[model samples]
Target: MQTDAANPSLKKTLGAWHLWGIAVGLVISGEYFGWSYGWATAGTLGFFITTVIVALMYTSFIFSFTELTTAIPHAGGPFAYARRAFGPSGGFVAGAATLVEFVFAPPAIAMAIGAYLNVQFPELNPKTAAVGAYLLFMTLNILGVQLAATFELFVTVLAIFELLVFIGVVSPGFSLANFSAGGWAGSDTFGLPAFTGIIAAIPFAIWFFLAIEGAAMAAEEAKDPKRTIPVAYIAGILTLVVLAFGVMIFAGAAGDWTKLSNINDPLPQAMKFIVGENSGWLHMLVWIGLFGLIASFHGIIMGYSRQIYAQARAGYLPPSLAKINPSFRTPHRAIIAGGVVGIAAIYSDELITFGGQTLTANIVTMSVFGAIVMYIMSMASLFKLRRSEPALARPFKAPLYPLFPGLALAIAVLCLLTMVYFNPQVASLFLGFMLLGYAYFWLTHKQREAAPDDALLQTARSLVD
Candidate 1:
């Protein structure tokens, strides 16, 4: 049997421009909406507090994270690092957590897409529109990586421009009084409730920075990952940080920050303050916002499919998932497989009611929970790999070393604890998902070849030669 890497394999066609597209494309939606949910928990100033802390964490995390990504440069991202540092079991856990993050994220973005469409066409059911969005994007992804990335680039550029437009339009209307309108949530003032609100807001704060790490997942597809990954990752996270803070401040001040706090389309709502509800600019924001969501939705599907391909190629998943399209040079089977799971999760409550909770509510919790796990594991792996493989020919090194990664690890652990405490039911659900992942690993993942990491790394080396 010719190995998967040798047959119908990934093509390294992505450069710094394309890599930046994938990086920003995978996370640009954060600027449009989702992050505002922190306001519901922490209020405007309180959410700002959460955003600042989470931003620091992602900053430290990304800087330290590039070191691992450049050194290993595998499609599995965090899994590749953990596997190198820990072994088969650790690798399996990291990969599974990654699947959780990538797999569920699309459906959440799909929900947003549906909501965005419903605003324009009130007759359309959100769920129906969501499923259609999935089919459209997945088909585009399966057709070719270059085409999909080109589309990603187009939409990401448009999305960023619209965001800048939003800031400019809202600047005159921005008010310090409105920004601090609801400084802290709940009936109780500054006490345990305020502190807990900040803690509870962690996941929503994370929504701003969620899948930025996903750029690293495209290591296998980057033209020159050693030079490209660090550039894209660093520049990408910084862009998002500025966007996150900018959008939050402008949106909060433009209108009733309370009303715009947590919704599918906060930008439209906030823009209403300046442009009026029926104005052309407000409508423009609504339509363009759909593209923003699509950018991340489409980009992350590409991210997850690569991860699915990597896991299957290594025998952690069924072999069929490793099938690459001979013409497109993309993992066609993995793309379809992940799309099916996303569609299923879209209607999971309808398929089998899980406590009557919406799929986005239940599923996004898992994605965030899983993202935190990958962060902690990846950062820890950074430290371990440094100690264990001091001479492992690293092309890019983290700027602050122990300080950068240590801040990342500590903040990640804090967020994980906050997520569990505030979201007990969903946290329980995440634990259940982990158990299922463990069961799959125990039954079929023993007898490792110890060659996949070396093989995956060699795939990166091949890009240069």
Candidate 2:
């Protein structure tokens, strides 16, 4: 098999801290927005319960997933783990899911970004601002990985600080009565309707910690895979868990949480209720809250591009996407390809609506569907690898053996079923996208075989072996 020397590889400059930034930054936008939709369905109390369940699921999932990431240390992340445990077809499923999660997520964030900007400058078209965000971030990614990562780290720190500020500013006016009123989907008690509302709210709860696993995609670029990845994943998830709960509870308690539901700028609206419409804190949130959106948007752009490049190099996608820019040592083609898809999704906001939901809500649910699937595959891969490759080098074993991964897998399956039952239209769209991608992989597998000596293809073989 051709060695890695022959394949175009990413530059290695990322350390534990940088990986932490990527991990948290990829999902930080969840705290700022996209999660309030749960309130529309589950009410404040019910959504809080949902968030707690989802947080536990993520905590376990991240711990178990760290084992696979440290061992494989590939750009494909979960795709590599599943490919080694199952086969090429397994890789395709994981890759497609990861692509969907990463690609579809940004358009939602971009639209949120547009909404935030529009709050300040009413004349600015939100769609135009969304597209501009795409262009600016894509250029930053194409410039280089280190530069992009550094920028992500900077913005992520700013975003975290901004969330703290939001929590503090809103704390003074927080009223438990305001939060608990109609908290159980406005029902008098936790009846059947409230129970089903919690089930229906699963996807929005997932939006809070959706893309934390994207950090694993940077394994190939990390300075030390085993050690650095664990630190990043652990610290990243902990930080996000604190911020997610703090922001959610404090924002919900600030005033009548019901009005914040169904809006993209929930933080600003929450602050406006606490303070006044013209309060400086509210204005600050509209402006500084953008760092949260930008962090996730930029970080996920890094993630999806690497996933596309890795799969293309392995013959799961078009070969042209695998080519790294000679100067930047980055997957320029892959970055631009994902950007184009995201930009198209941005323009389709009004063109694609379902069940009277806003474009952001629909897109967030779609992305969460992809994420839950990827989590299931990754957890299963972890189990299979343990049984099949008993001697595989595992620098960091899962702390609880079968227990951690088993819980994660179980929660993920339940979440998927609940989401599918609640959002059949979005679920159908997700399934259709997966089936279409699988069909392409099935038809093109043999055709890609004609180029047996391809260096990148050989590298893929060596890595899988």
Candidate 3:
């Protein structure tokens, strides 16, 4: 018997622009914050080189990932691809990694939102504001995808404009000497320490382009995802690459790049260095920067919910999480479930530290660890699908066959290895979560028969063609 699992309850209201907004919005917060942590580890020049390497990896990965996105268009995104490629075990690994990435990311963004708001009202505890943001945006996502996407597009545009304005204002103060003084990890010459610093900084550089692939989670809600997703992914990646480099360079050069390191609200601080704290430009950044953090926070709430819903529907998660709100046609249960975890993480900020890092930095590293694992699984899925299902209809193929996917896979593996070596505490936490998830999955998943492969394939083909 064919299952309705293929035809999900989500509304198909998102268009190309909506998908693009989700793609970019899911990652814009990186430009505003989190990425500065890389500077603390690698120095300006070292982190710059590290970002270049990470950017190249993302560029290649996105080019290769689009083929699977268009062909499957499943809400599970990477999880679905791995499931089809390697079976239940593979799907579990990808799904758990995606969950870690999406779930952990919003807490970090929420803390940034608090930090931004605290700029205007110092009396307001950032943690309180962070908890409030979780409540507000989770409610919005539960309302509907169209409403959420529209709001995301509007804020994403404003955030982009704000970044451009920031770069313009800071350009006057961009001093080459200030940026180059300690560029190579505060040493006149590069050495093994500098090399290790770059390796340690890979996660933070990854912060710049972390969740762009989350747009794939919205494929089921997009209007003709096969056509629209390719446009969104391609345009989205290019838009991010340019913005990532622009924000990092000009912000570093605006003042002593050293001062900007190890802070959450780097943009306003960078602007303050150029325009002074009392300048109207600095004030504008303090307020408008909220949009950047909000966009990513809201967009990720949407992403994690869809992921929970998909896995639940497929029997990988608790079945009750698959329930969609009848009135809203949204995953209300799934949305709230993820929000609860995010809020707990917000409260745990500062209380949970690793190796002298802040909550935001530690959580950011954890999120990146998950992202690297997911990327490895996704690229591997692409290669497997190409060989196993040659006739599968692909609307958009990767530009370079073995080169793009292979590069992404190789880099992903390297990043994961380096992260484990540098961050044993956070890595242990990540591994523990994965193992707990796998244990639960193995114990319970055997009780129920998952949807037949033939039926799901037929459904995916129907949706794609």
Instruction: lDDT for model 1, please.
Output: 0.84
Which stretches of model 2 miss by more than 4 angstroms? 1-7, 186-193, 447-465
lDDT of 3 at 380: 96
lDDT of 3 by residue, 1-465 (tens): 222554347788999999999999999999999999889889888898899999999999999999999889888999999998998899999999999999999999999999998999999999899999999999999888899999999999999999999999999988878777687763433545478788889999999999999999998889998889999999999999999999999999888878889889999999988888799999999888899999999999999999998888788888788888877889999999999998888777554586889889999999998999999999999999999888888988999799999999999999999999999999999999999998989888653375334323555666443
Q: Write the per-residue lDDT of candidate 1 for residues 339-390, one digit (tens) a residue.
A: 9999988887754225434456556667899999999999989899889878
The model with the greatest lDDT is 3
- lDDT, model 1, position 139: 93
lDDT of 3 at 284: 92
Each candidate: what lDDT? 0.84, 0.89, 0.90
Q: For residues 112-197, what per-residue lDDT tens digits would candidate 2 score against the true structure?
A: 99999999999999999999999999999999999999999999999999999999998999888988888887343454658877
Q: After superposition, how far is residue 220 of candidate 2 from its true place, in Å?
A: 0.7
Model 3 local distance difference test score: 0.90
